[model samples]
Target: MSAGPTSFCGIELAHPIINASGTFDAIAARRAFGDAVVERFPFSAYVSKTITPAPRAGNPPPRLWEEPAAMVNSIGLPNKGAEGFLSTDLPALADLPVPLIVSVMATSAEEFSGLVEAVSARDEVAAIELNVSCPNVHSGLIVGEQPSETEALLEALRPLTAKPLIVKLTPNVAAPASVAAGAEAGGADAVSLINTLKARPMFAGKPWLGAGSGGLSGPAVRAVALQQVSDVAAAVSIPIAGMGGVESGSHARDLLDVGAEVVAVGTASFRDPLAAERILIELRGLDPVAASSATSEL
Candidate 1:
């Protein structure tokens, strides 16, 4: 069996498998592997690394700590700012075979509005994802952690553009569903979870990462991803792009069974750049519904 076409947020997708934000660097892969990476693009829709209003130096060294089936990262969303991305990276990414979804983060609604407006202006950008894990500069509250903040942010930015707005929910919250509901209520087209679990790895009784603590990812968070995805699905009527430690077709199937409209391959891509393709193939074998329901719809 072969994976059939699907749609997310009115955007046509070749398959339900897409890469999580910052996981697969399409440009880097193309530079390293040449056109082969582009010819066989792993994801149906490519999500760029999180871009901020200004350039970020990112965290210090010792940013990654590998556990048994997971890894902790304090990469700190390194990027060349929104203007740099629009000027330099956007041109290159526009050439990709798949649709591009730009992920943006900011500490305030004004900054977020600027990002959304700028990114959405580009014809090549198919959607915009809001990375809301950071603290708001005004209230000092993590927007994604609080339902009201999430809703208010979305409400402020909803009318900026007609493009789909996906709120990337943080898993640190006790009731992520409420936040998802808030996003949906405030005009989010969709919601994605779980971002990462807070972790402070230790080595020799000392903190391992330079940032002291980081977000945990990989197989260890699969169950948590499932639970949160299910919870958010029940709370919001919009679509979901579920991701955590998806490494196989069975894992993808598990997410779909729980309520994810699409599954994102993250840690698995670290091991194999073409992991999404394999997972899609395996997923076709496991779930015939994915193939039978090929019609495109929002």
Candidate 2:
């Protein structure tokens, strides 16, 4: 156990500070910081990068572009397929000092089910986070964009395993609360937000990212995240993992005030791999009891 330990979706976490799915790469960190980093890992829970049904080569060059207050990335969710992930990445992540949440994305409900079943079988994975950014083959709308679609997807995968399923919400939606309601009705253990907003930039008569459009993250999306987190919290009673431009404890406090049960450190980790520890210290300084209590219940 660690200081200010709490629970999320029945999993005991050392603290409320966890990494967003694709933000902090623990394997890379270990290579850079060695055993010391793993000995005092920053996050109470570790979320692995998103995995897909099939291997992805990723987008071409110019994958990441720095902006004024944030960054735009068109990395294209590149990763080894499910089998490769289970064989390679899973073993490497199992030894981390915190519960692990595996993130996955697919193009269809059946594909999503396959991913859910496969990842849930692993003992190291405490939960599964659906990166609902992939487009649905039938509706053509992104899974996270349509409330009905989200519910239907959840209904299909709910029985696949008993492991907790978390739906990662997209901020680029008209009614995030409604979608959250759907997830609750379909049996989601928790919900996280907001997956970067769609962004497109031009320079020298050319688009910035090779993929033409990218997702913008960092401080620029903090306000949007707060509004969305509050809306979803009001709509659903399940645990909420909130994040967006969380650079300090005050920023994280805002998310909790708006009803986020756990706060995930994302973009800021790019600048400081140990940013979560600093944020947690600051968050405790504000109201240690309140911060600990948020994730302590349910």
Candidate 3:
């Protein structure tokens, strides 16, 4: 019956509104909005940008190309690496009032486990979100596509860290629910999805993004996101953090109405940094129990 506040995987979030990992940057965001970022901080819990084991230069220039309603990005998860994040970026973001969900990706189970342990040791980190949806450079297969691979990855990474492990599922998979089931079976504390789909576009007779193909996100994928969230939520027992093309409070509620415990705002953040906050306010006005109960019966 309660709706003002909610807790996901034991982390008490002031509201269900949160940013999708790699979407909002609290550091750079502060420079633009100044005092406003500290005052409201759009997301209830800030999910850090995707961090890798080593430094990455990322894809070549022209990494982002704006489309009509959606944008294509092949940034390739560029970062200063985990060490830099832990030392420099993290300190800058540590003082924020909201919980921090660190997004991490690695090539193998061992590397993933190491990252989990390292990040888990940090007191500022509230949860560890594993980005297993990335199409591996070594194995053409995506980690989140196969249930066996997803389960194995989680099993290896879970034992190395005590912090809550939230696996980010891939929408490109055959059966999104089976992937979520794998995460739960492997002891994942929670699960989130669906990451952007692999997309390709040749804008005006030339390749748009440098990588040729990039993950597609924005309002264009809202329906796919809803279906994926509903499918995964039905298959898993753990809490589901659902997101994709959430642009409005009604869009956020649509995901929640499908069984998502929490909704993440992604592309919308770029259009309106205050979008998540607005959705939170709107969500507060709705009846959480009634909405969830109705969805469960479907």
Candidate 4:
């Protein structure tokens, strides 16, 4: 059996598999592996690393700690910022065979509006994903943790672009469903979840990461991803991109069964650069009919 095409927010994709933002760096991969990396690019749609208004130096190391079937990271979304990304990276990323979704973060609605306007103005960007994990500079409240904040942020950003706005929900909240509903009410075209669980790994009674606490990812967060995806699905009619510890075909299928329209490969890519391709092959083999059915619904 052969798999059919899938679409997210009006953008047609060859498959339902995509890369989690920040997990796969196409530019570095191309430098390491050359054109083969682009010739057989793994993800259906490529999501860029989180970008800010100004360049970020990122968090101090030790930034990573290995755990059983998981890893904690305090990478702090290092990027060359919006200007540098547009001037340097966007050209190379635009050359890839897949549509591009740019992930962005800001501390205020005003700042976020600027990012949306600038990024959407470029023809290379197929959509914009708002990374709502940070706190609002004015309210000092995490935008994704509170439904009101998420709704207000969406409302502020909705008018900036005709492109799809995907709200990347943080999993630390008590009820992610409410936040998802709020995003929908405020004009979000879709939502993606299970960004990573908060963790404080200790080494010799001292915090291992320089940031003290970091976000955990890998096979350890699969169950949490499913439950949150299920809850968010029930609360909104918008499409979903579910991810967290998805290392196999069965893991991807589980997220789809729960309600994710697309499954993003994260930590598995660190283990194998072509993990998304392997997982997509396995997914087609496991249940081509189910994959086809899900694509039809999308």
Candidate 5:
């Protein structure tokens, strides 16, 4: 048996099965599923969706489209933003069974740093997962696409944050592993990845998603996720939070085997909100109870 508890950035997780941010909405989900949802929170830690400086209505209509064995989304990180997140959302999610990692994004490095400082002050926030995959409005360079940009962004925010800084990398890059290395060079405590492959869906001879392009996620991306995690883990010294298409215990274990420290369930939660819990149960079954209860003849 592994000697230590499944953890990420020193936060002990009851299990490695954590819900991917944007995929699981704890408060809304609880309201929908009631006690059933509360019974199995479906994650070792809860990650809030991307928060910005102010509220957003999100992209126009038709933000989601279904494809075979996967889903495409251009929801555009629609959220209540920082002030509303702290005042309204955090309080409600304060009682999650595990730590709360807040995911944040912005248009510039300074904005990213500001968001980090704001969320870092919260008592319930365990860590800050910086979404650097988005295109930077100021320079038009995705921080995750260029190693230098990622390094600079991390360097700017690292000093402002005491909590673990997790840089979420975009899979749309030519070499995500090199980007992950850049994050580590700038003092990122950990990294999470395969943040949705850039994709588009078509139906009835028309674009299926409102934005014409969305991040593709689900079972279809699992193999790519595994490879990226493996490459990043080999390239960096920090822990990797492997995510993308993990939907079951075997899938989670496959990630761990590939050097992922924690497995994040994304699209699976959309289909079965209880998938994380089910994965945890399956992981628990891998070790016999006797491993910890072997009788020693004195």
Candidate 6:
């Protein structure tokens, strides 16, 4: 019973299972599985892939490289851009059964501001998830890597809309808790974390991925995510949507034990598109209240 409902940043959800941006595609899912997929959607909220101000073809080639416990991706945030997203993508996504969170990224503050303003204006958007992986030109640092940069970006965009602002944090930083604290200081409603670890693999004296390095994800990073989630949860009072190596209900519960209000399935979905549903079912079968206190996080 404890698993049936929850509220996140003012939006009601059937459950806390959500997919990582770029991991699950609802429009494509509906195309492949039909309307039933929408009626029985796995996630309570649908997060669109990161869209920039203009269209991008993505990296040159060989963007994905599989590893023992995970995979690396340099696929880049290939998308149809802001204008294309609002016109072409938003219409179809609006038909989903749950709330829609648009994920956006830009090279500059003004560009990011434009994205937040445009997406927030849409009737279909429930919230905006700012992917902080972008580099800050003024500080010569990536937004997720620097606490000050994250705070400044959030400060600039917070006034644009009343919708919830969920900052997606990168796991590359030494102390992600600081970034989460900064995000909170700048008025973020919540935070989704452990975007991926920077990694590179080589084979036969050459890099495996077409791009020399990429972000690593999957089961291997779960421990790292748990630690960071625990740290960030301790650092900020706002809700947290924890994600990294989530594959099953037990894994989701683990994140919840560490104080994540929600858990996102990433690499596991590539293997089983319906993994989220299975995870949700498993999660519901357990006692959510009993599980929440199973661990004392670091």
Candidate 4: tens digits of C-alpha lDDT, residues 96-211: 99999999999999999999999999999999999999999999999999999999999999988999999999999899999999999999999999898999999999999999
lDDT of 6 by residue, 1-298 (tens): 1456678888897678888999998888899999988877888899899999999888867899888999999998899999999999999999998899999999889999999999999989999999999887777789988888999999999999999999999999899999999999999999998898999889899988877889999999999999999999999999999999999888998999998998888989999988998888788668656346323110
Cα deviation at 238, candidate 5, in Å, is 0.4
Residues 1-298, model 5: lDDT tens digits: 2212566888887666777889988999888877666565767788899899878888886899887888889998889989999999998898766799999998898788788999999889999999888778887987789999999898888889789999999999889999999999999999999899888788899888888888899999999999999999899989989998887777887888888888899999888877776776666556455224323210
Q: Which portions of model 5 miss their true places by more than 4 Å?
A: 1-4, 289-298
lDDT of each: 0.91, 0.89, 0.83, 0.92, 0.84, 0.89
TM-score of model 2 relative to the true fold? 0.95
The C-alpha local distance difference test score for the whole of candidate 5 amounts to 0.84
| Residue-level lDDT tens digits of model 2 in 118-177 | 999899899999999879997788989989999999999999989999999999989999
Give the range where candidate 4 is weakest over 10 consecutive residues by summed lDDT: 289-298
lDDT of 1: 0.91
Lowest-scoring 10 consecutive residues by lDDT in candidate 2? Answer: 289-298
List candidate 4 segments past 4 Å from native. 1-3, 289-298
Residue-by-residue lDDT tens digits, candidate 3, 36-152: 787777677889989999988899867777778787788899899999999999888887878999999998787787788889999999999999976555566778888888888
TM-score of candidate 4 to 2 decimals: 0.96
TM-score for each of the candidates: 0.96, 0.95, 0.92, 0.96, 0.93, 0.95
Per-candidate total of colliding backbone pairs: 0, 0, 0, 1, 0, 0
Question: For residues 238-260, what per-residue lDDT tens digits would candidate 1 score against the true structure?
Answer: 99999999999989989988999
- Candidate 4 CA-lDDT value: 0.92
For model 5 the local lDDT of residue 72 reads 88
Between the candidate structures 1 and 3, which one is better when assessed by lDDT? 1
| Pairs of residues at least 3 apart in sequence or in different chains that clash in candidate 2 | none
lDDT over C-alpha atoms for residue 262 of model 2: 89
